[model samples]
Target: MTEMVRDNPALARFELGDGDALAVAHYRIADGAMIFTHTEVPRRLRGRGIATRLIAGALDSARARGLRIVPLCSFVVDYLERHPEADDRAD
Candidate 1:
């Protein structure tokens, strides 16, 4: 991904891209927890690990705020399974 992506909680998602090629990792916050809902990357950006970066950034933000993560999205669940040390776990 040529464009650097950042976490944008004001939009309720992490976003990359400026045009129709945009990608997003969407989530919701509830009960002091963050629910990772889904991750979408344009086909052109799919193999570049953009989703992984987005997930990492989002998880990091959640951790900074002391928010527990509820991995509703399969991608997040998979990410957590592979990186247990991330520990953005839900109570």
Candidate 2:
């Protein structure tokens, strides 16, 4: 299973693979508007849908907080493009 946690106020990271193989990191903020700054799923974890999960989690968090989203991160922008339901929260 992927172990993910909000290690900090503006960051959520997930550990993938075994030992130090790779880690996926995403930076996000839920100010008046939700903004996702960065997303990176190491090459080893690339095809595993980790990015999707990260963005979904961020979007869920935004929804819970009743905040609009501004997807500055390319990954998030692309994800939202594919998932139109998420676009409703865009600001």
Candidate 3:
């Protein structure tokens, strides 16, 4: 199933899905950059591409705002590494 990721600026995170299946990519904005600090997925949701969706959504939002990315989170770094198309958006 396709999940919808929502940016909760109040919480400084990009959220995906809901309830028990919810996942999040945590970030902080600084100097026109989105610094991705962490990513989390429920144990039951691992290896299901949920984290990938979350990162993609977060990156898309940053790109839409014309902000660069600082991927401090390991997962986000790896995602960017695998997707060269996103390099333009990264710092």
Candidate 4:
């Protein structure tokens, strides 16, 4: 099971750990926007919707903070493209 998404601003990433493996979506605030920089889900954790969840967490956080989003990561952009729910949240 995925734990609640937690922000580690010092590292600029939202962490989703599943005991042994971890998934993360990174972001940085710039020019009043949250720029999503990267996303990584351990190979073993692929196809489990972990990246999707991580992206959701990141985007949700951005919205909660009332920040625009500049998705620098292709994965994040693609994910948003596929999921309109998140795409609508992008800025």
> What is the lDDT for 70 in model 2?
81
Q: TM-score ranking from best to worst?
A: 3, 4, 1, 2
Model 4 C-alpha lDDT versus the unseen true structure: 0.85
Q: What is the lDDT of residue 22 in candidate 4?
A: 83
Superposing every Cα of model 1 onto the true structure, what RMSD results?
Answer: 2.0
> With candidate 3 superimposed using the best TM-score fit, by how many Å does residue 61's alpha carbon deviate from the native?
0.4
Q: For each candidate, what is the lDDT? A: 0.83, 0.65, 0.88, 0.85
Per-residue CA lDDT of model 4 for 50-78, tens digit only, reads: 88888888888888888888888999889
Residue by residue across 38-70, what tens digits does model 1's lDDT show?
888889878877778778878888998889999
| lDDT winner | 3
User: Can you write out model 3's per-residue Cα lDDT over 3-91, one digit (the tens) per residue?
Assistant: 58899999999999745678989999989899999999988888888899889888999999989999889999899899979864453
lDDT of 2 at 20: 62
Give the residue spans of candidate 4 off by over 4 A: 88-91
Whole-model lDDT for model 1 versus the true structure? 0.83
Error of 4 at 90 (Å): 6.7
Model 4 earns a TM-score of 0.90
Q: lDDT for model 3, please.
A: 0.88
Highest TM-score: which candidate? 3
Indicate the worst ten consecutive residues by lDDT in candidate 2: 10-19
Per-model C-alpha RMSD: 2.0, 3.1, 1.4, 1.6
Q: Per-candidate TM vs. native?
A: 0.85, 0.71, 0.91, 0.90
